[model samples]
Target: MDIVVAITLFVLALLIGVEVIGKVPATLHTPLMSGANSIHGIVIVGVVIVAAHATSPLAWVFIFLAAVLGTMNVVGGYVVTDRMLEMFKSDKSKKGEGK
Candidate 1:
């Protein structure tokens, strides 16, 4: 694919993603984050596939960076989701301790 076409598609995707995500309700954000993390996991897999074809030091560096960033995104999403879930749990342990 031509570089110009690829860049145009990327820009369009970015704009659409931002618009869609911006409209999501706050209550649904955790689920959205979880879904995004799954997408990022696919991105990491793509990075690994790309790494296999890398022929230069710069390409290797970019692949490595992509992998690291994707991993961080997945981990961070899970942490956020976990914290959100914790908010909904009852403090049963605390109540029992007070008895």
Candidate 2:
């Protein structure tokens, strides 16, 4: 498990992720984001597990940052999903509607 190999894999994953996401249609982005959020929830769990075993100050800092960022990402995803759903809802107070 060399550092160089790990970094290379990370960079490759990043590039592939960006390319895949960039090609997604705007209409499908919300659903894709919703799914990604669920995955992030799992990431949060993993962070907690890592935090439990963390010993060094640097390890704790990284774990804390991961937890915070993962939580934010999950919350933001849901907010986006909710707003997208709202777009499809009809307004009851609109003039001729629901009269």
lDDT, candidate 1, residue 93?
Answer: 57
Model 2 / residue 59 / CA error / Å: 0.5
Q: Compared with the true structure, what per-residue lDDT tens digits does model 2 show for residues 1-99?
A: 699999999999889878877677686677777866755676788888898899999998999899888888777777877766565343334534844
lDDT of 1 at 26: 84
lDDT, each prediction: 0.77, 0.77
Kindly report which residue pairs in candidate 2 clash with one another.
none
lDDT of 1 by residue, 9-46 (tens): 99999998888776777866777777677566667778
Candidate 1 Cα deviation (angstroms), residue 60: 1.0
